[model samples]
Target: MHSPDSLYQQLQKIGTSPALTVYGEDRIELSGKVLANHIAKIANFLVDEVELEPGSRVVLDLPLHWKTFAWALAALVAGGNVVVGREKIADAEPGTVVVTSRPHGIELDSGDTVVALPLGSLALSWAGELDPGVYDGAADVMSFPDSLLFSGLGDESNASFYANAVPHVPQGRIGLVSPSVIEAISVGYSTLSSGNSLVIVGATSTADSIFATEHAESFTPPVRI
Candidate 1:
C-alpha cells in the first residue's frame, strides 16, 4: 500500500472506490475514477487556461460541495496553494486566482482572475451568461484532458499537515455534518488518504437519517467558532 504524503497522492490512493457521496438539495455520487477525472480536468485547466504556476495562491470562495472538493484537489495537484475561508480570500494579495460560485453581478477586483463555477455536478456551461472577464470553470475545464500529466511533490511534511488538520482512520466511513468548505475538504482528503469514504450532509434531518442508514463509523459536526 502507498503511504499518502500529499493531497494528490491521497487522491491517487483512493484508486477505484466510491470516494464521496454528498447529500443536500442535490444528491451526487463520485467514484474514485470519476473524482480523479474531475480533479485532472480542473488541474489541467488551472495550469493551461488560468496559467497557474507552482506555489501560486488559488482562493476558493465556494460552498461545501463536491465542486469545492474538486477545486481544492485540482489546486493541490497543480502545485498551487489552496486558500480556504472567505476572510482569507478577502485578504488575499493581488494576482490571486479566485474561484467562486456567486452570481455574475458581484463586484470582484484585486487584480484577481475570477473563475465562476456553475456548481452543477455535470454541467457543461454556466446556467446564465457569465459577465465579461469571468471565466466559466465548467466550460473551461471541458477543454482539458481527463488525466493530469504532472505529479505533485509529495513528502512527509504534507502528510503531517493533513494528519494534524483531520486525522484519518483507515477504511473508516466518515460522516460530516454542516462543515465549512475548508473543514469538509480537509476531512474528505484525510478520509481518502486512509482508504476511507465520506458522507457529507448539509441538513440536520438528512444527516441524522444518513448516519443511521450508512452506519458511519465517525461523525464530525461543524466547528463552533
Candidate 2:
C-alpha cells in the first residue's frame, strides 16, 4: 500500500480509472489523471493567485457539490488550512480566503479574499457579475498549469480536518451521499486514500439511480469522522 502524507499526494496515486463521477445538473466524469490535473490547477491558483500561505485558513462556504471537494483538495494541497461548510463562513478571520457559491449572500471584512464558484457541472465561469474584488474561481483556475507549481504539503498536525481518523471505505467504486461537507470530504479522502474510485450524487434522492448507473458496489457513509 502507498502511504501518502498529504491529500494531494494521495490523490496523485489513484489509478487511471474514473476517479470521480458526479451527477448534478449534468453528469461529470473525471479520470484519475484528469482529476489530478483539475486539483493542480486549483492548487496553483490558490498559491499563485490567492497568495494562500501555508497554515492560513481557507474557508469553503459551499454546498455539497463536486466543486466543493475539488476546492477542499486544492486548499489542502496548497498547505492552506481548510474549513468546510457554511457554518463558519461569517466567522472567517480577516486575511483568510473564502470559497463560496453564494458570494453575494455573505458579509465579509475587507481583508478577506473571496473566490466565487458556480455549482454547475459544465460551468466555465461564474454565471453573472461578481463583486469587484472577488475572484471567479471557474474562470481563473483555467489559466493555471496542469501540474502543481508549488509542491509542499501541509504539516499533518496543523491540518485538523484531514488529520482526523478517517473511517474505512470499501476498495471499489463507492457511492456516497454525505449529510455535511465535512463528512463528504472525509469519505472522499478515505476512498481515494484506499485507491478506490468514487461516485457522488448531488442529492440523496438521486443516489440509487446514479450508483446503479456507475456500477458502484458498496454504499457507505460510516461514522462521520
Candidate 3:
C-alpha cells in the first residue's frame, strides 16, 4: 500500500483513474488526470493572479459539487488553509479569499477577494454579468497553465496541515446521500487521502440504488436538519 503523508500527495498519486463521480441534475465525471489539471489551474490562479500566500485562509461558500471540490483542492495545493462553511463574506477576516457560486449584487467587505464559480462542467465564462471586482473563476483559471510545480512545503508539513482538517479517514468507494458542502469536502478529502473514490448522491431516496450500482463500500444517508 502506498502511504502518502498528505492529501495533496495522495492526490498526486491518483494518476488517470476516475476520482470523482457526481450524480444529480447533472451527471459529471472527472478523471484523476483531468481533475489534477483543473486543480492546478485554480491553484495557479490563486497563487499568481490573486497572490494568495501560504497559510492564508480560503473561505468556501459554495455548494456540494465538483466546482467546490476543485476549489478546495486548489486552495490546499496553493498552501492556503481552507475554511468550509456557508457564512457570508462579511463574517470572514480581511484579505480572506472567498469562492462562491453567487456573487451578484452582494456587497463584499474591503480587502476580500471574491471568485465567482459558474459550476458548469466546461463553462469557460460566467453566464451573466459579474459585479465589478468579482473575478470569474473559470476565466481566471483558464489563463493559467495546467502543469503546476508545488514545492517549498515539505511532506511532513503538508501532512500535519491536512491531518487536522480531516479527522475521519475513509477508504474504498464511499457514497454520500445529500451531504452538505462541508460534509462532502471533509469526507471527500478523507476518501482521497486513503486512495479511494467517492460517489455523491443528490437525493436520499437514491442512496440504495447508487450503493448497489456503484458497489460502494459505505453509504452515508442524509441527516435531518
Best by TM-score: 2
Candidate 1 lDDT by residue in tens digits, 1-225: 222234455555677777888888877878777887888888888877877766667888888889998888777767667777666666766567889888455555656688989877768888887878789988888878888866652221133343446443345888878877767777777777666788888867657778678766546533421
In the predicted model 2, the residue pairs found to clash are none
- Cα displacement (Å) at residue 112, model 3: 2.0
Model 2 C-alpha lDDT per residue in residues 1-225, reported as the tens digit of each score: 222235556566764778888776677888777778888899889888888877788988888777888888778777777887777776776668989888996677877788999887678999889988899989988989988886555452144555354455567788876546776676677677667778877656767876888899646555654
- For all predicted structures, in order, the TM-scores are 0.83, 0.85, 0.85
Candidate 3 lDDT tens digits, 9-107: 566678777788888787787777777788788877887888787777788888888889888777877776777765645577666898888877656
Error of 1 at 156 (Å): 13
> Roughly what TM-score does model 3 have, to 2 decimal places?
0.85
Residue 53 of model 1 has an lDDT of: 64
Give lDDT: candidate 1, residue 118: 89
Output the TM-score of candidate 1. 0.83
- Which of candidates 1 and 2 is the stronger one according to TM-score? 2
Query: After superposing candidate 3, which stretches have Cα over 4 Å from the reference?
Result: 1-6, 86-88, 152-168, 221-225
* Deviation from native of the Cα of residue 194 in model 2, angstroms: 2.5
* Model 1: ten consecutive residues of lowest lDDT: 153-162
